[model samples]
Target: MAAPAGDNVQLTDGEERAISSYFGFDCLYDHQRKVISDTLLSKDVFLSTKTSSGKSLCYQSIPVVYQHRQLPVIVLVISPLLSIMEEQVHLLRAMGFTATVIGKDPKENNDIKTGKYSFLYTNPETVLKDDEWREVLMTEVYRKTVRLIVVDEAHTVTQWGTSSTEEVFREWFGRLGELRSLLPGIPMLAITATATNINRRKIKQKLCMMNSIDYTESPDRNNISLFVSEIPHAKPLEEVFGWLVTAAKQNSCPRTVVFCKSIGDTAKVYGMFVRELAGCHREIVNMYHSCTLPNIKEKIRANMNDIDGSLQILICTNAAGMGVDFKGVQSVVNYGPPQELDTLIQQLGRAGRDGSQSLHILFYKNNK
Candidate 1:
């Protein structure tokens, strides 16, 4: 394995050129540069940064740097969402890199076994359930081609992994700790957009990271103006919809995402929006949830990211947000208070990604 350079060493000409040519960036952010340098030096990294903080680049740049040096190294990215995994693969391929998502196609899996791909994107569920894929990963690790393992939404290990109520999460995410055992001595990188101090500690413990370098940035979104409204519990849906419609009209049809607590509520809210818009605006509205078919979910995601597409508004549950990038989302409306502060911060991070002034509205029901 190729070791990382010293922390104080400047990027080489080749590394600088790779960033410029591949990502179209003249220079990396200070944090990105530091993390990449540290990781290359064989350090485990725990990056707890805000959304759009260039965390992905910190890990993404490492493989490119290694490949540029003619060192054969592959990265295994443990992504939580299919949407995020798909987007990462798409972006990497567009940049002329060999990247593929696991279980999407037989040929992709074959490529992994044959050492054809440089980056492999997968989820914990697939890793735990599929024997063939697991075998291929083990083979690659044994051969030392898989140099780094990145856990994208590291907070999920604490949020879902430790949940006493969700057995599926416990069974899948709980087993993530075993990765350290499976491939000892390999550098691990864990990243999340939102995590409290306690959550951060739990993530490191659950992943069994040793002597990890931790990086954190404030979660505040200065470009987003947040507002919370208390409403009557009875018929709160009408108030939420009314506020959203009025806000949309006032904001001149800006891209918006309405988050609900349940899939049923997501569908109901989407239907209500369709009924209310009822014309030209209706074409821009849609809903996304886990229950939605994969093809339809893909379409929804594509449309949301499309700057020119008619689809501008999405009614979704928390399933739509984490690590899923949607540019130019001007507003994020929560149907009610989120169950926790981390979730609220994650949802709010969706908007204002473009650095334009955006809005985050939270509706809280009056207990009385």
Candidate 2:
């Protein structure tokens, strides 16, 4: 097996050029170069950087270098959100690379065994419970061709992915390490948008990466201004949004998102907005959560990407936290702060991804 690079820091000039050509970036920034460099040299890597900081590029560059040299290898990405997995595959395909998600398309399990792809994306449920993927990972073919196993949102493992099974869909993230025993010796890359020192240690420990390299970057988005307020606990739903509701009434709510810690809260908030803007609910606001149908989630995602797609304000739970590309957002509101600081940061990072100035306003009643 040609395992991922070891003991090599800087990518070779040729490797760098290939990555530049493939991703269309001029060259890697020092942060990316360092993280990718350490991944090449370490037994494993836990990358803690801010959102939209090209963390995906760190993992994707490995496969690009291998494929550029005509090496036949497959990189497996374990992402928590189905939407993000599909979005990742689409992004790779647009870059002229082959990528696919397991259990979500016309893809067959045999395709994985045959090495018909350069990248394979799957969620934890597929990894742990799905018989086909579990079986495929044990195959001689996978043992030989699979080069790296990447956990895209690494902090989730420490937060244990959405609190619990009933809370969100990331519980499998903490249990991800069990796979290391199944595919021993395959270098792993765990990347997250945010993690404290304690969170980082827990993540590395849970993933069986105690010996992993650590790369840390400031998880700050300078373009976005953050504001916190303690709203009256007994206030009406309309008081929460205040003037933003007026904009929703006028069909001019700048692309905004309200994130709730729970699905029930998300529904309540969505109902409030729908009641307040009954006629324009379809045009101005939409609800997203773990229980939302896949097709509806896709539609909501599409609307977010479309600047004029009508649905501007998104009412969602942490399900929208990981990697749904809702670019061009102008403001984000937290109905309340999440239990984990990492979750709040991830949720806040969703705004201003396009580098536009944005706002992250948290309305709370009590101390968290």
Q: Which one is best on TM-score? A: 1
lDDT of 2 by residue, 1-368 (tens): 44433323446788888888877778997777876666655458878888877888887887776766566777889887778988889888887778898876654656766888889998888877777778888877777677778998877776755453467545677689888876767878998888988888878888899788877888789998999998776888888787788987776677999999889999898888888887635568889999999999988988888876777889999889887668688899999889889888888988998889999999998634
In model 2, the worst 10-residue window by lDDT is 1-10
TM value for model 2 = 0.91
Task: Give lDDT per model, in order.
Answer: 0.80, 0.81
TM-score of each: 0.92, 0.91
lDDT of 1 at 258: 89
Candidate 1: tens digits of C-alpha lDDT, residues 1-368: 34222222335777867876778878878788778877676678999889989899887886677767776777889987878898899999897888998888975666677767788888887876677766665664434776678999887887777775655454577568777765656778999988998888878888888589999989998999999977677864656678667655554677888899989888888888888777666777899888889999988888777767677789999999787878789899898767768889999999989899999999777878
Q: Candidate 2 lDDT (Cα, whole model)?
A: 0.81
lDDT of 2 at 36: 68
